[model samples]
Target: MLQTIHDLYDELERHRVMLSFQGPLSTDLITALLGAVERKMEGLEPDQRTRRRVFNVVMECLQNLFHHNANLTIHEGTTRTTDLPHGVVMIAQADQGYQVLTGNFMAGADVERLKGHLDRINALPPDQLREFYRETLADGTYSNKGGGGLGMIDIARKSGGKLEYGFVPYDKDKAFFSLNVNVTN
Candidate 1:
C-alpha cells in the first residue's frame, strides 16, 4: 500500500497534476472538481483567453463523461447496465498551456468509430473544419450516444491544433480511449 501510494505521488509530480478520484461519478462530484480547479488556478496569472479556453474545454470534457460513463445499477433480482460509462478526467498546467485528458473503457467497434471520426476531424483545415461542423449540425446525424460528433471537431478547431489521442487494450474485451486537448496561453 505504501509503495502504491508512493508511485502515485511520483507520477503526479512528474505530470504536474494529481490523480484524485475513483469510484462512482456524479454531477455534484463534477461541480466540486470544477470548483477545485478554479481555486487552483486562482494563484496563477493565466491570461483571459487561456483561462476561457481552459474553462470551456474542461466543461465539455466533464459533460461528455457525465453522459457517456459506463452505467451501473442494482435491482431486486438482477443487475443492469446504464448508458453512462466509467471514465477519468484530468486537467494540468504544462509548459506551453493547459492539457485536458479524458479516458474511458469502450467496445472495439465504438473505439474504431471514434478513432475514425477523430482522424477525419484532425485532418481538416480550419475553414473546412468550420464547414464540416456546420454540415454535421445541419445534417442531424448526431449519434444516439448524444454527441453530434461536432464536439471533437469543435475542440480541435478551437484549440488551433490537432487533437492528441491514444488507445490501449485494457483486457481481452475492453480498450481504454484517451482524448487530449491542449490550450496554449
Candidate 2:
C-alpha cells in the first residue's frame, strides 16, 4: 500500500521534481526520510546555507507530522489496528526553491491558534523572530499538548519566508492543517 502511494507520487514527479515517501510514519520512517533527503541532496550542488536551511525546514515539518497526525494505525500479521498519531509529508522541488509540505488533522481551536501564531511569526522581522525564539526556548513556559511551541517560529526563521498555511474543514469538529515552507537554493 505504501509502495503504491510512493509510485503514484513518483509518476507525478516526472513533470516536477520531487522526493516523496509514505509508510507507517514511525520514528524509523522519519529517520529514513531524513537519510533519503540527505542522499538525494548529495548529488546536487546546494550551497552550505541552502543545505542547512533545507535540513532545518524538513526536520521541523516532520516533527509537526509526528505531533499532529490523527490516524495512527499499526498492522501486525495481517491484522491492521490504530496506534499513535500519523500523517503524510511531501517535499518537492519548486521553480524558485524547495517546498516542504505537511498535512495533519487538528481541532478547530488548535487550528485557530496555529493560524494566529503563524500570522504573528510572519509579522515579525528577522531579528525579532530570532530573539522571540530564543526567549521562548529559554523561558519554556509555553507548551502545547505536543510540546515545542518554538518549532513553527524556527521553521519560519530558517526558511526566511512567511509560512504558507491552510486549514481545510474536514468535519464539524476537525480540520486539516497544511503548512508549506519554501527554502531557496
Candidate 3:
C-alpha cells in the first residue's frame, strides 16, 4: 500500500500536477474547485485567454462527472447500500500546456454510446466541429440530467484539440471512464 501511494505521488509530481480531487462530485464542490483553480491559474499563467480555456475545459469535465457518474445500489434480501457519485480529477501543467483529466465509474452498457459520441466529435475537423456545435445548440435538445449534449463539443472547441478518452473495466457491469483535454498556454 505504501509503495502504491508513493508511486502515485511520484507520477503526479513528474507530471507537474497542480491540483487533484477524488470523492463525491457535487455542485458545491465543483464551484469551490473552480475558484481554487482560477486563483492557481492566475498565479501560474499570465495569458488570460489560456487561463480561460483551461478553466472552461476543467469545468466541463467536472460537470460531466457530476451528472453522469453511476450510482451503484447493492441489495441482498433486506441489506442494501447506495454508493455516492464518486470521481477523480487532476489538473497538471507542462511546457506545452495544461491537461485536465477526470475519471468516474459508469455502467458498462453505456460504453459504446459514449465511445460513439466521442469518436464522432474527434473525427471532425475544426470547421466542421464548429458547425456541429452550432447545429446541436440550435436543436434545443437536452438529456434528462439537464445537459444540452454540447459539453463535449464546447470542451473540444475551447481546448482547441481532440478529446482523449478511454474505458477500463471495473467490474462485470461497471467501468471506469477517463477523459483528458489539453489547453495550450
Candidate 4:
C-alpha cells in the first residue's frame, strides 16, 4: 500500500498535478475543492479566463461524480452521509492547458448507454453541440439524477474538446467509469 501511494505521488508530481481527491464526492467536499483549486491556480495559472473555464469543467465533473456515483458499502449502524458517494477527481497541468479526470462507480447496466451517449456527443460539431444542448434543455427530460445531459454538454462546450471516457468492470453489477476533459488556454 505504501509503495503504491508513493508511486502514485511520483506520477502526479511528474505530470504537474495541481489538485487530487479520492473517496466521497459530497456537496461539502465539492465546495471545499473548488475553493482549494481556485487558490492553488492563483499562483500557477496566469489567465483568468482559462481559470474560469477549468473551474466550470471541474464543477460539472464533480456534479456528475456526486449525482451518478453508485453507493458504496457502509458499515452496519453507520449513517449514510458518513460514507458519502465514493469517487475520484484529479487536475493536472499539461503542455496545452489543464486536464480534469474524474471517476466513479456506476451500475454495469449503464455502461453501454453512457458509451453511446458520449459517442454521440463526440461526433457533434461545435455549433450542433450547442444546438443539441439547447434542444435537450428545452425538452424538459430528466435522468434519474435530474440532469438532462446538461452537465456533460456544458463540459464539452467549456472544454472545447471531445469527452474521452472508459469503463472498467468492478463486479457483476458495477463498473468504474472514468472521464477525461481537457481545457486549453
| Candidate 3, superposed: residue stretches over 4 Å from native | 1-11, 72-82
**Candidate 1, poorest ten consecutive residues by summed lDDT:** 65-74
What residue runs in model 4 are displaced by over 4 Å at the alpha carbon?
1-10, 72-83
For residues 1-185, write the lDDT of model 2, one tens digit per residue: 99998997777676354566553466677888888877766665358777778888888788778766655434664424355455667777777778888887766657878888899999999999999899888886755644568899989988888899998998887788888898876
Candidates 1 and 2: which is better by lDDT?
2
- Give a tens-digit lDDT track for model 4, residues 40-109: 8788889999999999999889889887866745588684864578888999997999999999999899
**Which candidate gets the maximum lDDT versus the true structure?**
4
Ranking of predictions according to TM-score: 4, 3, 2, 1
How does model 1 fare in lDDT?
0.74
Q: Each prediction's TM-score against the native?
A: 0.79, 0.82, 0.87, 0.88
Best model per TM-score: 4
Q: Give the count of colliding residue pairs in each prediction.
A: 8, 0, 0, 0
Candidate 1, residues 4-112, lDDT tens digits: the string is 9999888887888833454456678889887876767666635767666776777777777666543433467574435334678877778888788887776655778
In angstroms, how far off is 152's CA in candidate 1? Answer: 0.9
Segments in model 1 whose C-alpha atoms lie over 4 Å from true places: 1-11, 18-20, 70-84, 171-173
Query: lDDT per residue, candidate 3, 132-163, as tens digits?
Result: 99999899888876667798999988888888
lDDT of 3: 0.87
Candidate 2 residue-wise lDDT at 59: 81
